[model samples]
Target: MTVSKKRTISDESRVFQEKWSHNYFFIQVKEKAICLICQESIAVMKEYNLKRHYSTKHAAKYDMIEEKLRIDKLALLMKNIQGLYLSLKTGHKDSEASIKASYIIAQKIVAKSKPFTDGEFIKECMEVSFEILCPAQKQIFSKLSLSGVTIARRIEELGTNIESTLKERISKFIFYSLALDESTDLSDTIQLAIFVRGVDSNFNITEELAALFPMKGTTKSCNIFNALKSTFNRFDIKLNNLSGVITDRAPSMIGKNEGLIALIKKEMGTCGALQLIQYHCIIHQENLCGKSVGFQTIMKDVVKIVNFVRSRALNHREFKNFRSEIDAEQGDLIYFTDVR
Candidate 1:
């Protein structure tokens, strides 16, 4: 009973057996092999070749997707660094961490471009790289604080420019008037106020504050004149353009022979310097008239009688009662006036 001598397998069957037994990659389907894991027949190709195809093509697609993501992250980092550079250029105060973060982002951008071996070259590139990202309206100084010296220097510069502009316009005017006044404040500091009036090219009267100076001595005509001359020279205003002067009739301002008006006329000319019209202050004149001898004498007896009653506390009550009785009969108090 030779049982067909254990049907010896051929070379083809041996080769097939060997190939089937060898390790073969498989395609992932739902995290497992599609045919074997799901128990389905892969009619087109063997499991090994299918797995090789899926790995080479599908796995490569994943690598490309990851590379794209990395590139996008680098681009975002560069954009953030540019924003921080702009903020610094505009003098915006940033935290140390913020600066370091921006620097790191910039370093990453630089490093990824090429492998920088030289330290100096790398530093130079970093310095120049962020400069172009600076904002257009960059501030040289921060607005946080300013020293007194800085403020004063700026003011001096502005004043010099203004003075230069004014000098050019001053020569264009032919005639000008000067008005002077003195005032004392609550601090008892005397201020000399000066104003200049002139007609512009349009022939309209223009008044401007010429100068405000501290009075060193008494407001004398000579002192004021000297100050005016000095101020005019400082501002480059020509004295030959002086045509008129106006001042109040105070003794120092309008003394008969020695006053501001007299001094100006003496220095300049009578044609260019003339006294202003006298319109006496009505309130001051009224006060003086009330204290005149005629009005004082008329009120003297009434004042004495009132003071006699006011001096005694008991007589004051009786005086008030008497006055009330007289007022009651008079219907209302009447004030008499003299037409003259």
Candidate 2:
């Protein structure tokens, strides 16, 4: 009977040689041989294994280089690896530019009342345009993150920045007037929008959207007052600096008792030297006047014409098709909102 002998390989033979880097473009990494070009790892440091990997994978191109040309090729590969690392270091700078671009696009999207998901589609169209117009810019556009989530975050950031800047401007105001309006959105939520017109000590006048509060419940006079107070507190606005309040003829806005204007006056007290001026919104008055009996005669005819095209499904579709045939910018007549 004879005992079978098992072959054993020592750690020294497993150690990678320095020459392998120049010979087969493989480097010693944690005791394993790693290919420079493909980054594939060789388990054993045997020359035959490295040679087989190089010959089968990269030898067709790299093997053609000899002497100084081989050395230069090796140097170029090393430089490429270094370049990859350097790109990561400069990625932060590129990210700032990308963020600015994203905010500009987000502003336009918000202004146009576009859904957040449109950002992705816009990016795809922009990339295609870039590919056709300037292929060199494709890499730059690829860096932008215009996904819906990213766009939402970017818009939120822009809003916060604007709010902060507006607050800073408000703090410097010598006098300011507020214009308030309330409307229900498609979701039936009451939205209260407030605008501020302010003049600083330097007489620099600034007008901006001060607040847009959502009233989940009833939008009563007291509720409107509370919302205004919250906005004032948030912006650190002083009550005495208020010059005027502007609003439509809504009872909740201009009521004598417990109205938003009355509530503000009550807070300011009766003994103030300068009286708080109340201004009815001229635009709102004009809109109300436009619906008066005198204007109704003309508007009725306009409404009839609009309804002729919009009242029926077939009429609407045919009108749209006709408009398209004529290359009309407006697809159909706009139905009058307050027409009776």
Candidate 3:
């Protein structure tokens, strides 16, 4: 027995015919057959469906019109629909451009470490620039949303995307190092910053801030080690890949018996024969040395000597000439006291 297959909607040729527009006063607007009288759309493109809709709903009002009048009406409706479709198409493109611009502006603001409210200032600048260069684009520019809240949302979305990409790359790390620092915020809350520098099998190195953990309670060596272990677990990477640790070298970090580095070494030793390098931050070490040695006292004497030489016009000119003769850097002693 032969079973016949039913024809699917895809099998039918449903293109709108030209005669239907003139006879039924129907025209295709964005693929749907629309009646000129009521501006109602017929979902099915078949002549039968279009005819039935016109006869049932609008035939009484428009049936009395002459042939010339019907043709005129059809032409006017087609013109109006074309204009509306054109405007809608332009609006769609402008909307997409506005969204892209918003993201770009948001990213720039964040990269510059500016506040979210700066987006409003940026929008104002954009508006002024547009007005000066091309006033016709004011309407399109207005579609962009650069409010403070919108900027914040865009920045958060960007951060999430970057984090997602980093997670994907983390799984491929052949070796990695960590850098840690702790500081107190404006609210007096301690923030432990963890940064990762990882190398993949292809030897591509990626370095980024992994996380910032808040420590409202104790910030002991054990606390730091536990937090680090939690971070490693979250990333789902092997402990064997931890090749190095860089730290600010506080007593809690470098203590011989119970430091964070000592704890990590013990953990890695049990896993296997591993070589983990412990590094102290050079800049931090320098800062500590300067503070301990009273760098301010030394700088005070130097500043006094500079003032003695440059305070008088004669001494300043002689010093300048002497420096030029020696090919020294071009600068007078101008110290910014705020810098440490």
Compared with the true structure, all predictions reach lDDT values of: 0.56, 0.87, 0.87
lDDT of 1: 0.56
Off by over 4 Å in 3: 10-15, 27-43, 64-69, 104-149, 270-273, 291-340
Backbone clash pairs for candidate 3 read none
- The full ranking of all candidates by lDDT, starting with the best, is 2, 3, 1
**Candidate 2 at residue 310, lDDT?**
87
Tens digit of per-residue lDDT, candidate 1, span 7-35:
44342232222222112212333333332
User: Over the stretch 54-131, how does candidate 2's per-residue lDDT look in tens digits?
Assistant: 999899988888898888888888778667758987787788888889989999999999999999999999999999
- What candidate 1 gets wrong by more than 4 Å, as runs, is 1-74, 88-142, 146-171, 186-189, 203-205, 255-257, 269-340
Model 2 off-target regions past 4 Å? 1-93, 270-273, 296-340
- Tell me how many residue pairs clash in candidate 1: 0
The ten-residue window of minimal lDDT in model 2 covers 6-15
Q: Write the per-residue lDDT of candidate 3 for residues 156-254, one digit (tens) a residue.
A: 999889878888889999988999999999999889999999999999999999889898889999999988888878777577878999998688898
Candidate 2 vs candidate 3, lDDT winner: 2
Q: Per-prediction count of colliding residue pairs?
A: 0, 0, 0
Q: Give TM-scores for every candidate, taking all chains together and pairing residue i with residue i.
A: 0.40, 0.61, 0.76
lDDT of 3 at 30: 74
